[model samples]
Target: MERIKAIGIDAGSTAIKVVGINEKGNIVFYKVEPTSFQMKPQLEKIIEELPKDVPIGATGYGGDLISNATITASEIRCHSKGAHLFLKGPGTVIDIGGQDSKVIVIDQEGEVIDFTMNDKCAAGTGRFLETTAWRLKTPVEEMARFAEKADREVQVSSVCAVFAESEVISMVAKGEPMEAVIKGLHRALAKRVASLAQSLNIIPPILLSGGVAQNPVIKSMLEEELKEKIIVPPYPQLMGALGAAIISMESKTKVTNR
Candidate 1:
């Protein structure tokens, strides 16, 4: 028997993730790259890294722009599908990404009920943290670690990313520790995200998805704000891709069976 392969692509605002799975749903290959506005070139680059015979399924902000995908899916559907695959419960999903953030409510069967998205501003998203990291002379990857070490409270009052950058700079000039500043940043972001979750009457065992879900500091802050346990998948960032792949495989099976 010949092997069957399925590929999933998450073409996000900042990054692109590609994954290949076998008939048994085992990941056989994966690749990630920075996303670019020029979709064709980027798609070509990612496709070059995957198995040639695999059918591609794409989802995310740039999914519609990719011409090579066998199917293009919505980010919301992909994230919800991905979250349900890992969470397997009735609860909410909070996805904080580079340019936007969203809160999705899912039922027991992994279907989305209600959701809210923030794409207008950079205030509570990963871009806010990135700006803070740049101003503090700290790497973005290490910001969460520094926030974890903070013992004192520092407040970032502004919700606007640009104003928050100014606020962080002023705090630094005032001799505030970097950890405290980062902690404050995380707290502000968590507050915004928590507000979104609360809008949907936050339920327990909230699943955190997207790239920012990997930030322990943000997770800790959000947990405190919501007073609930948060679950982070083993590969938080890859959930969307995996979900898309799973959906593609399932649909193919259904078609074949019919």
Candidate 2:
């Protein structure tokens, strides 16, 4: 069978991911960039990097803005499709991105059954981690490592992002270690996500997606809260893009057969 090439683009709040897949669904090329402006230039750059013959599909919050793309998909569908490909089970998906978090429930066939999203606030999303990292004088990438070293628990009682910052400051004033504070931040975020998952009656083998899934501490905290193993894809951030690409291939096959 001749391999059909397809491209998938996930234009997110903070970053854009572009992935190319062969007929066998293996990623042939992948790239990521900061979504500095609207996605036009970013899409152009992605198209330039991919093979010209490949068909392209777009998804994510900025998907509709990329008018030249062949097809656009909802971020929820993309994330669920991508996570299901990797996790392979009936479960819930919690995706914490730069500015939002979403909980999606998937059936045994990898279809999205239901979903909830928190796009209105920064409290339960990656923005919380970024804010905490800034205040702790640590890079966001190092947060998980720092959190793992926490020797004692530090409670973050505020649900508001602003109030949580103030609360973290008070904990620091009391000589709380940075590790403990970071751990608390992870736990707090996990608790909110777990609550969302619970609302849908969380099934086993929960899958975590988005950039935050790369953080080991958040994954560990989420697992602890859910009392089940959480699955993280190898390229968690690119799952949406991969899902769009897979969808594009399927669509093209149908058109050709018809």
Whole-model lDDT, candidate 2? 0.81
- Once fitted onto the true fold, the runs of candidate 2 whose alpha carbons sit more than 4 angstroms away are 1-4, 253-258
**Cα deviation of 162 in candidate 1 (Å)?**
1.6
Give a tens-digit lDDT track for model 2, residues 93-164: 888888878888888877988988885778888888888788878998998998888897688863877678
Lowest summed lDDT window (length 10), candidate 1: 249-258
Q: What lDDT is obtained when candidate 1 is compared to the true structure? A: 0.80
lDDT digits (tens) for residues 22-111 of candidate 1: 887666766777777787687877677655655667898888876666766777777887788777788788999888788888888878
10 residues in a row with least lDDT, candidate 2: 249-258
- Return the TM-score for candidate 1, rounded to 2 decimals: 0.91
How many backbone collisions does model 2 have?
0
Please give each candidate's TM-score: 0.91, 0.91
**Candidate 2: residue 184 lDDT (0-100):** 87
Model 1: residue 247 alpha-carbon error in angstroms:
1.7
